[model samples]
Target: MKRRLVRKLLFGAAFICLLSTQAFAQDGYRMWLSYDLIENPDKLSEYREMINYVSIPLSSPTLEAAGEELTPGLSGLLGEDIATTNQMQNGTIVVGTPGTSDLIAGLSLDDELNQLGPEGYFIEHRVVDGNHLMIIASNEEIGVLYGVFAFLRQLQTLQDLEGLSLKSSPKVEFRVVNHWDNLDRLVERGYAGLSLWDWGSLPHYEDPRYVDYARINASVGINATAINNVNADPKILTDQFLTKVAALADVFRPYGIQTFLSVSFNSPVDIGGLETADPLNPDVADWWESKVDEIYEKIPDFGGFLVKADSEGQPGPHGYGRTHAEGANMLADALAPHDGIVFWRAFVYDPAQTDRFREAYDEFVPLDGQFADNVILQVKNGPIDFQPREPFSPLFGAMEETNTMIELQVTQEYFGFDLHLAYMGPLFTEALTSDTYAKGEGSTVARVVDGSLFGYEHTGMAGVINPGSDRNWTGHPFVQSSWYSFGRLAWDHTLTAEEIAEEWIQMTYSTDEEFIEPVKEMMMMSRDAGVNYRMPIGLTHLYAQGHHYGPAPWTADLPRPDWTAVYYHKADENGVGFDRTATGSNAVDQYQEPVASRFRDLNRISDDYLLWFHHVSWDYEMNTGRPLWNELVHKYYSGVEQVREMQNLWNRTEGLIGSQRFEEVKSLLEIQERDAIHWRNACILYFQSVNNLPIPNGYEAPDHTLDYYKALEHTKYVPDPWYN
Candidate 1:
């Protein structure tokens, strides 16, 4: 009898969603938080029966946000106005902490709640006064908000709720989004559009998009954000800009996102009017301490500073003959009073170093235990820049005595920007799953950053997510998948990329098996397809010098040798690839044990990293029994073929999704195919010039000469004004 009533209500809700669909077009603005009506009759019946009403006494801001989200979300899904009751009922969905509810307190959930920490929560079916109720219980208000999103996700994905008991917590303590947005409204390496933060209109006019940004982030368990470029302007720390930052903090507070800033290291000299910004100087330390106090007065919960000191012309203690730790520790001391932490980037490189891959590890490993407790060295996933394919950074588990964080680039800076479809879930997971062998074989990069390997005081995972003023947030619709995957994996590293893609597709588009399977498969193949045509088999940094939009393997003239493509892939007459073994630069010595030994050996190393660690001869036979030159041609051609397959798959999924977004993706795939062909032709032609080899029989010849490809101009590239 109960199931019959639920089925009737679900059908009514589906009718309402159908009507709404006709009125609105899919523009991808909702992303993965779309709360469409449930389609499956049995699953809808179960959800409707379980969540008849929501009981959330709005005692705190976070609880209020949870209630506001749950009320409307359930109404849309169940096709009825879910009652907001102050009192519990037979089918009540109670969301609260132990301190906020006497019922939850009396239940004696100390053992479970204690183990979950402050940010963890559990959804359990409870019997109170002989009434079965779904209780979303936690130790804090923020956890209740996370629980609400998780519950909605279950309904959206049509998970069975029979005897459901779900407990979840973030694997990493700080899951942060790092925005390379500058004060002038242009973003560095941003492909979507202009910066999201409208500096000209901020502090007085809060855009509705701010709330939506917080909602999207919180839905995936992201807890923090750094909202400026690492190449920062010192003016952002001025009193006028603090007011603007405080306004944003107010909007993000209820959603459990603490705001952070990317600060210039010379702020003491630039903003505070000091003669020098020396870390050890008493006056400089005092200036920073007072400045931090001023900031706390406006934004009490600020997450602290992200500094890009001593790299890429950014000012640091190096100018004053001081160590990196001294610079970071000084800032850590200033923010310690407010319980804040510092994210000091370890993306340093020197032209003097033989290999850029060894720079960060060499500079940082010696000073491992010197940093303060609140300081976390933010290391990029790969030692070289954000490459399409490269080995994991040797810095991951190297500094066992110091707190560390993994920094990932969600923006498609090196993978064709917003023009191509490249889902970065595979890229992110590949870096995380790498074996560091720090303590033993099981010491993965995920374990190191999560503080499980070394029991570090602080742990984090930061992603350079370049969402901008574009209507869809990210320019390409598929880039949202990488952002979504990053947040989900930060919450639970155990979840696979395939699982995340399936759920994201279901929530953002349709739950139809045909649509979900094909779209998910397309997303899974995107990262590899991008790597193949662009930089297959450990190739790195071969893009055009400034814009990095297209292939430029012949580029060797730059201010610095490390800035040129020839510095990375040394394609000479005899062979291609940079040798990083003991015979060459000895960069493999940075990794521990079996990893170092495996990379040093030609026979033992994986083919994926063959060229990265060794400069092999053109005639050297590969595992496929083909010569090195032939294998390179095969990979470059196959990459173009994979992209064509993606286009076909997307074309087959035409009517399954909304025509607006469907057409947008369809046209973008056409562009990707053209770009893939350009990459294949340019790279293969350039490499052939050195090897003096003919094109294999099966591959198509380049349409244009090598000179034509080199002279081809790319207009409107490089988002940052300074790059231009």
Candidate 2:
């Protein structure tokens, strides 16, 4: 009897050990969708009681995706297996479109749904048979899928679901992610890892990763995706590639996410065998119309084309001496018949132009009202490329006749790559909330992009997505907040940066109040810290050639004069910074009278953006009562100090968060500290070389010479996927 009892006890212990090992193997590839087992038993019990079963009536791909996501999430979170049913049971959660479910149709909710639009959903709790039931209803099946994710999010955030009644809708019509991904699976400016789309195995072997990708995107407010780099390949429009694109579109459709293509402007001539691709030419117009027709046939709900014509060596109507309006309107006309819109990029600049910052404004402001109704001129946040700190683009309110979409880079191209912990939420808010003062005092860039300022029909926001095939989605785990923040801001631009950081922290790391507060502070200060250390006081674009890794303030001899770091900084013994006032580049004159005048006066200009508009003497007195030279030195030193503080804050969190994530962040903070010092040393050393100024009394001098800093090269820097 003793021997039998011993054998049974040993078997039970072995079985329990195997289960523990299985649980440990699950990494965070699922991201916030992980739905890990809830640690709080009382909370788990309550969730299980609230969600006992799920009823999904619709059976489309998106509907199926919703069902698939819900089962795993609920099973993991509630610690119970929640079965799916065709009909609503007592205490059931019914999720479907109004057309398919009687419970949804009979609620007289169609009118409310019309107000909510096709992408919105209504979540309500109804009591039937003395049992409470939750209903997630939408005007379309895809909305139902979004509703499911929304419901799950509320649970994940530990929000009260009892007596829940809410109708949520996207403020913008189109919230899209522009992936600078190439056919070779490389992502341009993508620091995460390889491209998420497995092109080599696509159109045949459907990777499950694609489905998860759509699920996470739908969970946020992202409704559309442009799959290729804006500097596009004409071959993508060929028949063979259409099949591959169609396959991915089908995968995304059920999640309410439409797929868009970035088409090369010369596709008509390059792919259709036309002699010339001029917009006014009849054959060119006909070819585009036919090509769009072919795309729509393959994927009926294809979003549209994202064109980078006449920008950065890409072909456009400028090649034929035609206006940008003519080029965009031609594509707009082709897509108009199918209800598709054209996103014409306003990133034009010429290498030959003396002032690169003035190029886009000069090119597009003149042809503002000539674009077709179905076209949106996509403008980057700043006049120049995605610099760490820049003045708001003059084009935001300049083009009143055309629809505008704010293009933001979620990827940290100029700010620091994945190695540094820079949260871009504050950076995004700075640009969005900046008062352009075009129509009036309250005319902000957010209002311009959301269609409220101009009172135009179409307006939207697009972020260059930072996702890659890395196990953590984004390379640095914390960098995921930038992606999340972009979608949240796109959904509602009014959200404060602090609020977004709090939400991301609670959902991503821990809901524990202790972890949330300090981490939120760290995220809030991160962007400004990066700016101070890397490019303080409005100095811009001093990154090294090609890789853009670190300081290269002395880089003056590149093929294009504008490509050099010195072209922007203009640091010398006399002064530092670009002169964009009336006397110099006159870039500030592009804004309204009040804004331009405010920037014209060096005293009136904010010190943060002082160098962006005006070149000042090294001895100029700043508002801080210190000379410009002293203030600049203080900012650089303070930036490095702030990075050390971030590391200290993270170290205190060692035992408070998950071991794996904590260790990952801890190591990243170390890298960030080292690089922050590198930035401080390199930038200060180079500036001191130009200014011939001594290092301030108390601050430490750089350990190396300016030549030593310049000799450092990153030849092994990974080329953006598209560049390769």
Candidate achieving the largest lDDT: 1
What's the lDDT of the predicted structure labeled candidate 1?
0.87
lDDT by residue (tens digit), candidate 1, 379-441:
999999889988999998899999999999998888888888998888889999999999999
User: Which candidate has the highest TM-score of all?
Assistant: 1
Model 2: residue 645 alpha-carbon error in angstroms:
1.2
Predicted candidate 2 versus true structure: per-residue lDDT over 1-724, tens digit per residue: 3522333354334323322425532344655665656655666677777788888874465676677677767776676788877655766898877777776676577666887777788898888667678889888877787788888877777777788887888878889999998877778888888888777776875666676677778888799999999989888898888888988897787678889999998988887888899999998999999999999999999989999999779999989989999999999999998999898899988998878989988988889789999899899999889888888899988989989999998887876777889898998999999998988899999999999988776878999975898877788777788888888889889989898888777666677777877788888888988998999999988888778878788888788989888899888899988899878989888998688998889869999889888778889999999999999999999999998888877777778876877888888888888788888888898888888888889998778887787787443234455333
Q: What are the TM-scores, per candidate, against the unseen true structure?
A: 0.96, 0.94
In model 2, the clashing pairs are 62-254, 186-721, 187-721
Once fitted onto the true fold, the runs of candidate 1 whose alpha carbons sit more than 4 angstroms away are: 1-25, 127-130, 713-722
